[model samples]
Target: MKAKNGLNYESNPKHTPGGQGFRPNAGIEPVNSFELFGESVSVNLKDKIHKSRYTMDNKGNIHRFSPDNRGNYHWSGSTADKIKLNIPN
Candidate 1:
């Protein structure tokens, strides 16, 4: 059984144009909330540039998610504890 307040469970499928052997779903949510935040920044370090981002979930936690044309969702992280946004692709 999957947790209700933590890393939930999901099942996605990978397929080609035609019907063929399918693969396990790679897009699985590791968290809960679908609401996510995104911010980008550039930092200077020893004459070098570094890019970083700040992503947050609706409930407050690092988030990572991808949306399909259909706007479907997936995940692969925890929501309550070990919070990490792992949205499906």
Candidate 2:
């Protein structure tokens, strides 16, 4: 059957038109909130690595924070506003 997007769902509903399978939250970890820079920020455990951290603001914008050589965290950059964690504090 053809889906509304014109993709053949009969073959595999899990895949899209280009054959890329849909994996919801594929590599995403649970979201946790933390107080960073005096503001409540939501962070994905998956984005927390040894060198950097990723946080989401209230407007669903992603911001990257990394530590300097002196071990002070600073805003690195902003990422695409795709993932939103609306979990309450």
Candidate 3:
């Protein structure tokens, strides 16, 4: 599937001892901008402030984040704040 931001996704599957299978996947590329205040705001992954806790750009703009209580990170700075990731079928 394609994300709203237009990024394409790929699927990865894992097979179990039985015929059952599962898939745990991730985005192939990092997402850049987010819809904030009705506009797109960029997040600089290179300038991370606290080891993935926040993303800051050259202009010093920051995108605050938090753990999902899982192993993944979640963005919380905008209305559609979640990372625009493509989910592969």
For all predicted structures, in order, the TM-scores are 0.24, 0.36, 0.29
Ranking of all predicted structures according to TM-score, beginning with the best and ending with the worst? 2, 3, 1
- The sequence of per-residue lDDT tens digits that candidate 3 reaches over residues 21-78 is 4322321211453331113223445464332333454455554433344443334342
Residue-level lDDT tens digits of model 2 in 1-89: 32232322122212222335634532222132223323423355555534555556676665554445654454433444234333321
Please list the C-alpha lDDT of all candidates, in the order they appear: 0.34, 0.38, 0.33
- Find the candidate with the highest TM-score and give its number: 2
- In order of lDDT, best first, we have 2, 1, 3
Q: Per-residue lDDT tens digits of candidate 1, residues 1-89?
A: 13232322233333221224344432233323333312312245567653222245555655433234453433333334343334322
Q: Which residue segments of model 1 deviate by more than 4 Å?
A: 1-28, 35-60, 76-89
**Residue 73 Cα positional deviation in candidate 1, in Å, after optimal superposition:** 3.4
Candidate 1 vs candidate 2, TM-score winner: 2
Model 2: lowest-lDDT 10 consecutive positions: 7-16
Model 3 residue 47 CA deviation (Å) reads 22
Candidate 2 ranges beyond 4 A from true positions: 1-48, 80-89
